[model samples]
Target: MRNFALLAAGALSLAAVATVAQGVEDPYIWLEEIEGTRALDQVKAWNKSTEELLAQDPKLASYQSRARAILDDEQQIATPDRIMGDLVANLWRDAKNPRGIWRVSPLAAYRAGKPAWRTIIDVDALGKSEKQSWVWHGADCLAPAYTRCLVSLSPGGTDADVVREFDLSSGKFVDGGFVVPESKNTAAWVDADTLLLVGDFGPDSLTASGYGRIAKLWKRGTPLSAATTVLEGTKTDVSVSPFARQDGDRRWTFLTRGKTFWTSDVSLLTKDGKVVKTPLPEDASFEDIIDGRLIAKLQSPLTVGGTTLPEGAIVAYGLADIEAGRSVAPELVMAPTKTQAIEEVAASENILWVKALDDVSGKLFALRRSDDGRWTQAATALPDNSTVRLLETAGKSDTAFAIVEGMLTPPTLYAVTASGTPAKVQSLPAKFDAATMTVEQKFATSKDGTRIPYFLVRKKGVSGAVPSLIHAYGGFRAAQTPGYLTGQPYRAGPLGMFWVEEGNAYVLANIRGGGEYGPEWHKSVLRENRQKSFDDLHAVAEDLIRTGVSAKGKIGISGRSNGGVLVGAALTQRPDLYSAVISGSPLHDMKRYSKLLAGASWVGEYGDPDVAGDWAFMSKYSPYQQLKPGVKYPAVFFYSSTKDDRVHPGHARKMAARLNEYGNRFYFHEYLEGGHSVGADHAEDAHRAALLMAYLKRELGGKK
Candidate 1:
């Protein structure tokens, strides 16, 4: 088993391990030495070569400047977070404030072009004062009275972060307040003097998947070590999280025991630290509590009290029934169709809002319960073919916010209510000229007869063999939705200005293993059926060529993270499909992925390789293991961060080394920091994006 072998070889030495359980020799394992002197030297050499190659592009300066300008644009929307004191909170980053500022304004003030903002914390200033990187991870405050909150800050943008209690009114960390040292952990407020803590408790306190195994109730004015453990999970379980929910006059504490990525167990915690197991479906996701009802989203079919509810439905049970251990019927709030999926479910005091997707487009609906115990719903008047997101919801009021945007439509913010017309509150100025371009939705038939949907953006009348780029992320139930350059730090304006306006086209594929069609769609391509995603992507490229949207040798593809692995498979399995590929923050060596940082946590998504059956399928398609000597692959560009603790930079490193050994044309770049994303700040992101755009233009012959 690669998992056991990797652990035996030490978590950091996948490259040094001579043989896995199968006795298979891995020659490039030395590249897995992330910080070894030899590995660092190799990374430096690769970075030099990549910089030289990209520096030769004549448009590099222009590309970088344009990207920087757009990233620093001031007309962007200030996304709202309805926090304590009825204020709208926004974390803003621009050229003037690269590290960003956490600021808040009144709802009406935030809607103006120049809001009167009061800065709570300046990350750059904090980093200077504290003499640390101090990247903001976010803050969770006491609900209803959100003045006192726990602030989570990472040293350098890693998953782990240190938590500290801060007072919003004073803009200062509370003296002698709660503070937890850096580790993968979480803390939620239970009351003014009590907190639900889940974090490292020294030896044998963490799961094999690298998450806290125990839930402890910590009281104020006491050492963290003295906290009492209320719930404990096994080392093999995925994770255990603790939280407290309030509904009207009742407050309930619970623990979510994650048995795997797809299954979980729920337990109620008593005031005396007793754990009470609750009977519920293993795949049901606890959404929220409102009106003394516990709402859950079902990932699998559930039958309760003579009524069977289908998968992908929202159901609710009375909190009293759950706590009383009595069998009760659940009220079905909503159900999804084959082409429709529930994107989000939230509650605002008395109203329940559901964000649903129909054929990859977004719609908003409001649901209400009648006295007869039936639910009535109505769709919002949001425009079609756009992405609608629930921005903020009030727990004690009837106020909510939703933002709607599309490929060509600029983002518009709306103030939504349970039974009134949605009012437009704000809108973002268009960053690029999209009047001449058109958006089209098309489908490509995959090898198994599945209709794969994809979005195409191109200039009017442009056709047949134009420089094109197709992108998709087909894992993790993360649906690829239609969006404009909204509050996102990375704007699509650069793509439209530097590519589409210059006679290039872009495509977004909605393939299997994503939640566009909900859980069933994602489950269809798990583990052994992973190739279905590759097939779906390949089919889209083929359709582009067949339908005159693109031509052979004129297309380019790009993806990061999981999508990077998809691009690697496409480059290795079908080299002639594209002219170039950008594999950023990729996972190419599947045999040893579980051994790397955060890789073990994802075994539930990708089955454990220690099992022979799982490895058989994984090894067959692993890009690093499948590279051939004379396959004539296209010139691939591999980019990543040396400090990426999630995927491990070793994946891209070893893959590039193997490609070099096979004498294939390729380029590589590795930055020393920035974690999995390969960028620490807006400036770093702009530069990396510029390099990608330049590489695409050079390889695909786009306008300079």
Candidate 2:
């Protein structure tokens, strides 16, 4: 069909170019090249197919039109600000307000200007003992109306006691603390007066155990009540849906552990201690239980709307037979054959929302269950050159709040109804007008003959060569879509810091290492081909310098997590290109990263060190192991969280230690709390943002 023809034409074009170049070997010779012309053409073809596919779909076209109209209408409301960073998880309107929507960041709680956020409570201020070293660890609000907020604070000093219930509205600590002794606690609110706490029960298990269960449900307001075990296991992944009200005399909670995805044994826990275990059809993964009786599951080799999903084969299921105790054979919900994987799931009463992607862009879709019990497909169209993230859902209105942005557009919060047009809720205030902003698309030829796509964002009418901070995350299947950053203090606020933004930040899209182009894209750059990612980034940076967007000594680079690996790779490969580098919670030491919490889950993305085949490929780019002595890298800033259970702090710590020992200039800071994000709460997020902005200002030659 058209896709095959396009690929053939692209190959022919590559062959022609190779013939003209004389130095090239074959059409595929340029596949390893970063930003080579062939690569750019391939990406363009992929994007073209996506656009054609969307255009052909009526559902997608309608949604796109509606989304575009909303953006066009909201453009006049507020001048978009630069979004410096965002809170990973924060408090926002659980439901839409009759007046207007409200979103409150815990970090923004301490901002000088905000006053609508009246001090519901301050746990540290009313503390009985520890002052200088106290950290808020866990927080959650009760359902229906989240009027009551509960927080837990642990003293940093010798005291291992964790204060469980500190009520925000009451402005006092609840009496008779639920102490976990020396164990860290992860709690979930079950009801108004109940909580599910997960931690270790014994001392030796607390100190040396890799996995801890001790899952117990405890009543909050009750005085030191005995804990009830809902389930017990060494390895357990628990997720609970908010209490649902079904037909008279029935309340249901869904629970799952091992073999839920592959084996599909999900238990429906009733208030009366009745556990109804439902098994799904073979090869189906139980996604979520919709409403009460309808269970959503995914089956393999699934096709939806005539598109084959790329990652693996999958079909969706909605089990209606409750008495059968097993999911009915699944029907095809959506099978986008080109997509590498689909991870996150969000749902409303009538629809199941899924975020998907091919090798070029991230796409979202919703499957609506009709009155006939059949599912109808709807493609959720977001703006071009931007990415959309679903925030929260409201039951009554069936509306969702989402954060939307693109390379040129500033991030804005929007209210999206199920079938109607989206409404703009709030936007970050722009310090500079959009008229003053200019973006240009450029291409760079990589080590091979491949052409890579890149973008440049700078202030209009600002002449001469400018100092620029170049950012990229050229790993994984994640694409760097264009979006707006409003209130980005470091990039825009202080002036003089002319930032050059690029979508090529994620350059592994088609080079066989990212899902953006599909499994083929990822497979191309896996193992020995990993160097293609580094080379792609280098080509972009070099193109910036060659094009006079930035000078060599005046340019800086940054990324976080896996992107941190990009920073290290760039420093090792092209130390002369950047003036400074900033990496946050980086996975610099790839060899030992698999042993960390959740790190083992990513071995499919990052190769396993234990495997001889992988080590040969990984050793070449592994930042921690590849550090060379007497080689001065760019001034680097490394950040890590001591409580970051995901990527171990050892990666950052070892990188800093080796860099410092070798007399390389670097700064390292490890925050004690904040988990892997290093911003457990809103206040901490704002502080982190301010610190990052300050660091960027100092490093990028902005006024301090």
Candidate 3:
């Protein structure tokens, strides 16, 4: 409702800006009205232009067909995900079930090549029956028993979801069970009969970032309104949420008060409803409890209890020692190097698996505590230069599943044990022919002499003047690793297969403002240093051109979310470097972004625009504000979703509308659903991918 109101004002302001140029008024402010009839009609008109333009391209039809086929392919590996106690679950979507179906299989069946899956919930059927465009968010089942669960369903893939209590045994929604209506909410089970919830609780319940500020304990058979408030945070804070961590028979409930996007204050919720403050660095994260010890990963150097711990280090302290009010010495777990960073941490019953990145490649390590209270670490032997992700870990055993893959390699799942060798569980069949494609790790020097690493994928012995696509995301500590595309079964590496195999190339830039190196690397390009990331990207592009991999009018760049802003900045600042730009679900209007949906939360990463000092640098890189009337910008396309509640669709909408006013040759496509991504269903994703590839081909002169 806040966004809609802003859109209405922006629309009126856009109309007024053309006549009354009194102050800095937006000319396309009308487009911000996400679901307004007038704004949607305008979007329809612009979409028609894009449709007509793409219709004339000969490759569009073939690209769309190929994309749809890839997405809808039945042979695509059903990625095994463990949920509840023993059931291995998977959410599957194909041509037959576009909305996807949540299905479960036994552990034995899952480990085998083919799983005998039984449908737990058909999202498409539920959506049709309810006459709503319900998108599957996911389900959170209680540990151990795992009979009853909380299922989250979103309308058109928005961040806001309706949470309903579900009976896993009966494969049906629980009657008169706990249900939370659509709002940005989070919940965790305190017990089968109780839940800790954080969400919109009527007036004054949300923060400036539009996140929940109140935490409540709702017991079974009680109305949500009557739920007892256990904790509360100020409206200026980012959010407050509760999470229950179970270690064997011990269950620890915690409430995290997010003061900012990167920092939080953690408190332990006791059985008697008392809040006990945990002493730790505010920037440090409470990872998980292992061996009756609380673990923390520090983002900044901190002096805690007379000892200083460096940034990018994981440390642990005894939970009993803290409770007993005794002086405790923190145990050093892992400290990353200047060129390395911890990516993720997964804990089994006894061992802790740490996923770290040395440079930009993946490294897996396992840590275990011995009988003498000494911790030992061992590196897990997986494939080199491949991204390794922990699929799931059981609380009762020292067992987990890990999936490893690279840009050209297919995803292979492995059953990881505590001390033994990780055994192979499943490997996806080759989706694309990578025999001719070779991947090279290269580096480009930034303006400050920082050597930025990037991956280049191209055909062997074929080099000069190829149609290349450069990709990057340089913000929010989110490191862009070398994965097999953001790829799915049918939507396999179409870029690798359709584009690269068809004589094109792809380059992934690991620029600053990302966790490619570590917290230092990310912080180096934050706030005022944001331009360094843009500079780093340009350096990569310049390197590609200098190395003869691509030419000025032959390269295209694509990025979504933060990367959207990255490409958007590139298109504006260095328009001559690339021929095409695909900016999806982007943040182009930085000046007013803080006022938009969930935009205020990012002030920690991107400083507040209201601050004059912050605005000076932000305005320089803001793509929407940087557009000039006479600039010869290349074929730039902006795509977004109307259902996006996290980043807000208005960012793309206003930018495209602004581009139109400049008489620039650009393309705009906003899906009616699918939140902040390509879309909710495979068909929508296929169309989105097809549109991007087709546009890139048309602009960069790819083969028909």
Report, for every candidate in turn, its global Cα lDDT versus the true structure: 0.79, 0.50, 0.81
Of the candidates numbered 2 and 3, which has the greater TM-score value? 3
Off by over 4 Å in 1: 1-24, 111-115, 485-493, 702-704
Query: Considering lDDT, where higher is better, how would the candidates rank from best to worst?
Result: 3, 1, 2
**lDDT per residue as tens, model 3, 318-389:** 877665556677777888877789988878888888889987888888898888877788988888888888
How accurate locally is residue 220 in candidate 1, as Cα lDDT from 0 to 100? 96
1 or 2, which is superior by lDDT?
A: 1
Per-residue lDDT for 308 in model 3? 80
Per-candidate TM-scores read: 0.93, 0.64, 0.94
- TM match of model 2 to true structure: 0.64
